[model samples]
Target chain A: MTTLDATLDHPRGGSAAALLRHATALARRSLIKTARTPEALLDVTLQPVIFLLLFTYLFGGAISGGDRAGYLQFLLPGMLAQSLAMGGIALGQNLNADIEKGVFDRFRSLPVARSAPLVGAVAADIVRYLTVCVVMLGFGMLIGFRVQTGFVPALAAVGLSVAFGLCFCWISVWVGMLVRTPGAVQGLMFLLVFPLSFGSNVFVQTSTLPGWLQWFVHVNPITPLVSTIRGLLIGGPVASHLVVTLAWMAGLLLVFVPLALRGYARRA
Target chain B: MTDLVVRAEGLRKRFGKTQALDGVDLTMRRGTVLAVLGPNGAGKTTAVRVLATLLRPDAGSAFVAGIDVLKEPQRVRRRIGLTGQYASVDEDLTGTQNLVLIGQLLDLRTSDARRRAAELLEWFDLAEAAGRMAKTYSGGMRRRLDLAASLVGHPEVIFLDEPTTGLDPAKREDMWGVVRNQVTQGASVLLTTQYLEEADALADEIVVIDKGRVIAHDSPDGLKRRVGGLTLRVRPAEESRVPDVLRILDAVAAPGTSSSPDTAAGARPGAVSVPVTGDTALDIAVPALRRAGIEVTDLALHLPSLDEVFHSLTEGVPAKELV
Candidate 1:
């Protein structure tokens, strides 16, 4: 029986190192799950490409005054931002599913840091957001969308969207921890993201909307993210929109990170 | 150093209207198994959760390996492993992947984690299926994998909440063997179950809880003794002689002893049983039957089983007498 004791010496390293190790391990598990069930990737892959195709062809002529190229240029960045927002929902759904399956109980019983599972789930989702951006960009270029800025600026645009998506994910994490079912996570996230995506400058300029609606569009969190991507990828006014977008990211983290952690801790 | 590895006193938790745990107390020495046996909704799971630091007790204190559960939960976590009623493994990952992930979470080095995972998979008899996704494994295999995952850190105290709840008899035996192996390896165990036989087989001390309160706590033999002394059964050679045999049994029975005929349809045609108080009753019974011209087909002494003890304890029998 001492053989069992010899096999499990206390894990080496400091507490912080242990936390990082646990987080990475959990992230690796998420990635493996995605790899095994490739269908789960449809949200970040097929969904974005389909959105790019259907929107670019169906609404381009009507919205852009018959100039499909101009509409494609405008729509690509908005679609990328939209896809990033959609990507954030997966984190909540995954967490909710894990909770439903009692997987988090195993995580809770471990000696790892309390926040590691939540943090690891968010980290793994960043990869999903990056995948969606690449797929959206590649699909958009296949038709007629061109990046007006240089390659570095276009990469920076995708990077910025990924960062924003990560920040937005805390809302989903919080919702996931608070809800009892995976289906509830999906429903709640849709209620939140649907209007934010449509009411903003994703398909058409906010100016086209009624005055009252324009006020909401201008202040919507997605608006700054869409505008920032538009400036970086297709060249537009950026400084003010960038600041608002950063502020929103910071505000979201400040509010939702603690909420998510607390919800996770409170859940037995 | 204190030999008691787990101690919980007056732990109370209420889930809205249902008091899941009401003033539950548990204690286990190092390298011993303390089995908490109870029916459904009897709060066995709740007590284990509080001790494992998965749930905070509404009142009272618990210490695991000398760490206060509520105040030093992290330290307690480091010294304990828990396998809940449900198989809590990522179904998408392979068995080896599951164990390795837990190992890594416990902060083992990458290579060490991999090695440990392989060793555990082999020990759990999952080496052949180690590369397959957990979703593909059968129920018994999934449970084994879950148990293997908990051992990745070699926890000093393990909480197994109904470890063999849904397992077949053979699989249950396998799980019992694994638990015994853990105890022999010097890890204290606190297990919860509804199976009295499971308690009899695995527990060093059994705590029987019902309706969120401990009804009795004793060793397997000690519990059986509470139901009283050896039972004497006498089967007559002729079915018509049952009355004569019962009369002789009653006459020979000591004062205060209860004697009854086996009237159930399935019972042998002429069978009678009597609770014999002292060892001398058996000696008196056999000679009394023969002297009365009663021929006997069978006569023997029987010890009360845990099943009878469990039934009497949970069936609203007074707890003070049994304790």
Candidate 2:
């Protein structure tokens, strides 16, 4: 009857197939929500662009000792990392709002998989993550930040950033499901993400940091992610950072995915 | 389980310090409307949620169409549909989009989903606004859309929690029609409502709840009779003849059935009234009052309104119980 009808007639499949269909349908809802309220997309688009412009111009020369060009290449990857961290905050807040608005009540009553709404919601935000990567890439390039590597590695960086953001999103989803109010979700998620983004190598080199902060900077989860993106986008040692970042992603999934699903189950 | 479409026994739930449901029991046979009537915070909604498989009760069990609510919620979900107090449609999506999405989620083919959506939108008088985002809809429109979404699945049992809360009189009548139509199509409905009139109009059985307990349950007319079957009232043409009418009522109506304690003055100011078991009050009083040469301006026999029935059932308890 309409464009969405194309896959509507798939032959009845088993449990996993049904779950995928439900998730895809719900993901379409989230994407439609994003598209309708263009302002919602601004968090992924304009936000990263503003961060890129502000940090590069405000402290670039001072941080790099008058070599602003070198600072752009170093700072752009960190800006991408910041976008990845900030992207999930909206996911948690929106989920909290949806829960509060009683939007999930119908879904709760339906025969669909319990995990579909949360999983679909996280899945839809993948588009937002990709948007952030592209917006940051184009804006960073326009502002003289260049990828010093081949096109394939640059594409890999985009893919890797989105994957990391998806992992980070489970933490947001868990908080969103657990917290009672949207405002509290926002505040708590910021409390979680703020430290991860700021306490890492996103702004300055970990070696240049004071002794007490250096340890946290090295172990800070965002540090490895930023270092990995940097290695992928520029010519550097990608293997170790890549391994550490992959470990962090695995840990995030192993712990938070189940935790978030449990929170969702307890919503009754 | 032979003909019962829904049943709950000893369902209990507590929220922190508040006991929301204390052993609430309810049942309905196939193809009927069971109205769960209550005031605010009376736990009527809580009972519906537990039966709808959205919440698990603390102790007691529920069976929707003979499937255990606690053990197999998903199986129950497939056989039932729920429309909550608040409208649950996506505000960002069009009214048409919201219905189609729910239809698709329920596994209708795309063409079928859209076809179903268009049918529901037209039925709800929302076709003109089907393309508009639900956020732009009025409260009544949004509620109709929400109800439409629930019917997309055509489940055997439907739980409607305050389904007509915000509707106008005409729309409320339409909702009553919807409930009747669902029952006609072989669906049983568990409807929670604060409106006593709605229960009277639509329910085959009415359960009155208060403070998390079932205070009364019966057919609408049965409840009215149980409260006090009928009232015989008379007002004399001459104020001086009131005493004569009261005497006739006292003599003719059942002993101690006259609710009016003011024996000399009459129970209803200028009018004398007594609760009579059935048509006996009318047959006995009319002849006796006529025989006493009582000239009366007004004389009638009528069942107590549901409002009075509801008040007597819920408001104040037992100095002398009304039911």
When only the first chain is scored, the TM-scores of the models are 0.94, 0.94
> What is the C-alpha DockQ of each candidate?
0.58, 0.46
Off by over 4 Å in 2: A1-11, B229-311, B314-323
Candidate 2 lDDT, B174-221, residue by residue in tens: 888888888899999999988777887899999998778888989988
- Give a tens-digit lDDT track for model 2, residues A108-181: 99888889999999999999999999999998899898899989999999999999999999999999999898
**iRMSD per model?**
2.3, 3.6
Model 1 chain B: weakest 10-residue lDDT segment is: B314-323
Fnat of candidate 2: 0.76
Clashing residue pairs for model 2: none
Report the lDDT of model 1 for residue A229.
92
Q: What TM value does model 1 have?
A: 0.88
Candidate 1: stretches off by over 4 Å = A1-13, B228-311, B314-323
Q: Please tell me what DockQ candidate 2 reaches.
A: 0.46
Model 1 - which docking category?
medium
